[model samples]
Target: MKLYPIKSGNFKLDGGAMFGVVPKSLWQKTNPADTNNMIDIAARCLLIEDGNKLILIDTGMGNKQSDKFFGYYYLWGNDSIDKSLEQYGFHRDDITDVFMTHLHFDHCGGSIQWNKNRTGYEPAFKNAHFWSNQDHWKWATQPNNREKASFLKENILPMEESGQLKFTDLPQTDMLKNSPLGFDIFFANGHTDKQMIPMIHYKGKTICFMADLLPTAGHLPLPFVMGYDTRPLLTLDEKEKFLKLAADNNYYLFLEHDAHNEIITVKQTDKGVRLNHVFTCNEIFN
Candidate 1:
């Protein structure tokens, strides 16, 4: 199996919102903010090439939104989903599966794109089966007031409309019974309802897709939960447990939002599980 880091792009978000109760003095040290207190974050996606299947995890924010909508996030950087796929000698049509961690715009927006006429939306990965769980699918489709903005219809409805949407029958257990991608899935409800974190076993190493569970190495601390999380207390418990498991097993966490760090290892310190080392994805994959 081969893994490729598909960088969709970078965007700025309010630092305070990213790091909930954490003070600016603490988070700013690592993710320094701009003049408006917005921190630059990477919408890093992962591509898995195993045998006949090429599965993509997350798509990042697509370029379909209006200028007025994008004015708020300030998307930047030259890296795009198409460009990153080309870098690996592939195209959107080459993808076989799109495993969405959640339905947030930044994660699933690139899954759908404007058609040729720019009149309607179409699946970005024409050949890929968009994978999401039943619980998450329902939560995103019928979003609550707090999370309604993140779950955009343009990014989601097209999948089902195109007859390419499928849901894995994931149980409510902490550990997945059977993953659609043949990887173990860990579910967390802190960030959003039933956010699936894929844990792949390859080359005697475990690589975990740290969705919003650990957005960055700076979020290693249990208290550094994002303000966007609906259940902050649940997040704290999930992070604490997951960190211990990662530290004890010496797993490599593949960060989705950390612009600088692609993968990180954790160690159980006196305080708690803290970042032990950071490395690029190639360094770990190779």
Candidate 2:
């Protein structure tokens, strides 16, 4: 199996919102906000190339939203899903699975696109099956007011409409399972209900796709959780448990949103789980 980091695009988010409860004095040191106090964020997705299956982990925000709508996030960058896929000599049609971590616009917006003639929406990956959890599907479709803004209907619905939608077939008793794509995933509910984090066994090392569960190295500390999370206390509990597992097992965390630090490993320091070493996929894969 081969894994590739896909740069979908970049956008800005309020540093304060990204680092909830954490003081700007602390977060700014790492994030270094702009004049508007927004921090840089990447919609970096992952491409898993296994026999007969090309799995895309996320799609990033597509270019379908109005300029006025996008102005809020301050989208910036030349990188795009098409360009990123072409780098590997592949295209959207080659993707057999589009496994969304969640329904957040930045994470899954590229799942659908405006159809030809711009009449209506259609699945962006025409040949791939979109994977989401039953609980997350419901939560996203019937979104709460707080999260409704994040779950844009255009980014969703079309997957089901295209008849290419599927859900993880894990039993209720299991926290992790062997995915059809030949990797293991454990679900976390703190960041949003049933956010699945992949634990990939790559070349004798475990590589985990750290979704919003751990956005960046700045979020390695227990208390620096995102304000967008439905349950911050649950996030703290989940982070403690997951960070322990990550540190003890020496997992290579493939960060999804971190722009500067791509991959990071944590060590059990006196201050609890802290960022140990930073490496890119180039270093590890080489």
Candidate 3:
């Protein structure tokens, strides 16, 4: 199996919102904010090539949203899914599966795009089967008030409408071994309802796709949960359990939202699981 890092795009978000309740004095040290108090965030998706199957995890926020809507996020950077795919001699059409960790706009927005005539929306990857769990599909489609803004209809419905949407089998336990996507899925609810974190086995190493469960290295601390989480207390428990497992197993965490740190390893520090080493995608994948 071969792996590639697909940088969908970059944008800025309020540091306070990203770190949630964590004092700026603490988080700013790892994720420094700019003059506007916004921190850089990357929509770093992962691509796995195994045999004839090319699966993409997350699509980043697509370019379909209006300028006014995007203005709020302060979008930046030239890196795009197309460019990144081309770097690996591939294209969106080559993708067989688009495994979404969740239906949050930034993660699956790029799954759908405006049609040629701009008359309506359509699946962006014509040949890919968009993947989401049944629980998350229901949660995102019928979003609560707090998460309504993040779950945009335009970014979601098209996949189902296109008849290319598929659901992974939910495991009875927190972790699902040997999923349909050819990897294990660890489910977490604190960030959102049934957020699926992919655990991929490649090159004799276990690479975990850290969606929002652990957005950045700075969030290694158990209490550093995102304000967007529906259940912060649950997040604390989930993060603690996962971090302990990550440290004990020596797993390589593939961070999706951190613009600065790509892949990180954690160690059991006195303070708890702390960042052990940082590696770029090239260092680990290439």
Candidate 4:
């Protein structure tokens, strides 16, 4: 199996929102903010190539929105999904599965695109089966007031309308496991309802896809949780359990939202699970 980091692009978000109640003095040291107090965020998705199956973990926010709509995020950089795929000698059509961690626009927005005539939306990955769990599907479709803005209909509804949507067949019990893509999935409900985190076993090491569960190495501190979490207190408990296990097992956490850090190993420090070493995929996987 081969893994590639598909960098769609970078955007700026309010540092305060990203780090929640954490003081600027603390988080700004690791994730320095610009003059506008916006921090750089990378929509770093993962691509898995095993035999004939090419699975994508997430699609960064697509380019279908209006210029004014995109202006809100203050997007930067030229890196795009097609360019990233081409870098690895692959194409969007080659993807057999699009595994969404959640339905947030930044994660799943690239799942759909405007049709040729601009009449309606269509699945961006024509040949890929979009993976989302039943609980998340309902949560996103029938979104609460707080998360409605992130659940854009254009980014979601087209997958089901195109008949390419597939829900994971795992029970709703606490922390279920499933390996539909040959990688075990660890489910968490704190960030959103039933968000799946992939635990991949390859080359005698375990690499976990850190989708919002741990956005960046800076977020390792137990108190540093995102304000967007539906259940902030529950998120603290989830992070505590996961960080302990991650540190003990010496697992590599593949960061999704961090612009600089890609993969990191954590160690149990006096303060708790702290960043140990960072790696580019080429240095470690290649």
lDDT scores of the candidates, listed in order? 0.94, 0.91, 0.95, 0.90
- Once fitted onto the true fold, the runs of candidate 1 whose alpha carbons sit more than 4 angstroms away are none
Candidate 2: regions farther than 4 A off:
171-174
Off by over 4 Å in 4: none
Q: Report per-prediction Cα RMSD to one decimal.
A: 0.8, 1.0, 0.7, 1.1
| Candidate 4 local lDDT, 154-195, one digit each (tens) | 999999999999988675555556467788887788889888
Residue 97, candidate 4: alpha-carbon lDDT:
100
lDDT of 3 at 100: 99
Model 1, span 87-125: residue lDDT tens: 999999999999999999999999999999999999999
Ranking, TM-score, top scorer first: 3, 1, 2, 4
Task: Report the backbone clash tally of model 2.
Answer: 0
Clashes of each: 0, 0, 0, 0
* Candidate 4 clashes between residue pairs 3 or more apart in a chain or in different chains: none
Superposed by TM-score, candidate 1 places the C-alpha of residue 179 at a distance from the truth, in angstroms, of 0.9
